[model samples]
Target: MQLSPDEHIFWQYGFVKLNATIVFTWALMLVLAVGSKIITGKLATGLKRSRWQNLMEIVVVAMENQIAEVGLREPRRFLGFIGTLFLFVAIASLCTIIPGFKPPTGSLSTTVALALCVFVVVPLFGIEDQGLIGYFKSYLEPTVIMLPFNIIGEISRTLALSVRLFGNMMSGEMIIGILLTITPYIFPIVMTLLGLLTGMVQAYIFSVLATVYIAAAMGDQGLKQEPEAQQ
Candidate 1:
């Protein structure tokens, strides 16, 4: 049901709004991710097997494989970034299951913050991979003359990444929401299945791109080597 304009404003700007929900939900996801790791590790150590242990193992193994393939052989290095990103995004996407809840990714702020987090981590990883001096020099790539343009390109890409994800996921939600409003029964079911696919794909895209960003920040500039011009 479309809310009255006044109700919409209140829903958006009231004390408990999307911003608060996003922060709280992400904090909850962080806590759960950490708690799950600790509890499962202890349980696995104490007992031969447990249901939660097996389930969590599957999740960790899948995430490990993802990191191994996209983040190179050193999956341990990606524990914090991939773990946090995947957990937060996974939880955020699932929030739509509650009628009153909205997916945080539906807001530009959430997606922008996520992109900024990846952008910031990239530099930190780069500096870790290459010392500060070496990292700064990497902006020059094949030549120092390219440094300014490279820097600009990097900044623009972070913003573009944010916008791309924000636009796709948010628009998808809006379209589905509209369809549900228009037709009560059949349309919503189809929309729900479609959304399920979209949600998973968006999460995968986010995770893969985050790994790519990390690789770049870790001074794997070779990953972006330009091909020679065709003869």
Candidate 2:
């Protein structure tokens, strides 16, 4: 079984090569872009609205609520980043039902790219909210001795985020591939359904964790557990 879409090369020129991971990733992005444009084109504010508009509202509201629950007081500020992350991962998994499609998340390069985005954005959001000096001060929290550990924590968490996503997605694809070849029938169908569910869960988890990291960077006041800690 192919462990990743990177192995499926479509074209090559010396070191430069196009692979399935890049193709599918771009295809997914295009779908999201066109879908968003179409959905938002006729957004109605009156009593009457299309089902698609209603569905889009529901998704936005739900995502905003989740951001609030994660301790970001202003959900809309973070909605674009968090919502896109969730949608991309969730859609990648959902598309697995289509034959010959592989989720880019299954590839380490893709997962690392996603993780690095979070890694960079977390600090940017923190600095935006806290200022450069204030955000840097977070590294010196509790005591000066903890600075190295705090830095290490940030790096470690980024690595964890990438590996966690890559492992889960790659394993699911591997299992489904194996079953499809060996059994070729009822069991594969069941596994595919389970994989879809797992994909949704992973997408939720990845988004939630990213929000937590951002919240922590934003300061204790913006963390969900801050209230409990004070009490």
Q: Put down candidate 1 lDDT per residue, 1-231, tens digits, no spaces.
A: 422111233245446554444554555677686878776666756557877787777887888787766644467777678767876776666655556556666667777888898888878877877779888887887798999898887788788777876776677667778887789789877776676677777787787777777766564442333222111
Instruction: Go through the candidates in order and give each one's C-alpha lDDT.
Output: 0.68, 0.89
Root-mean-square deviation of every model: 5.1, 2.4
> Which stretches of model 2 miss by more than 4 angstroms?
220-231
What TM-score quantifies how close candidate 1 is to the native fold? 0.79
Candidate 2 lDDT by residue in tens digits, 1-231: 578999999999999999999999999999989998999998899999999989889998999999888788778899999999999999999999999899999999998999999999999999988889999998998899999999999999989998999999999999988998899989989998999999999999889888888888886555555522110
Q: Pick the candidate with the highest lDDT.
A: 2
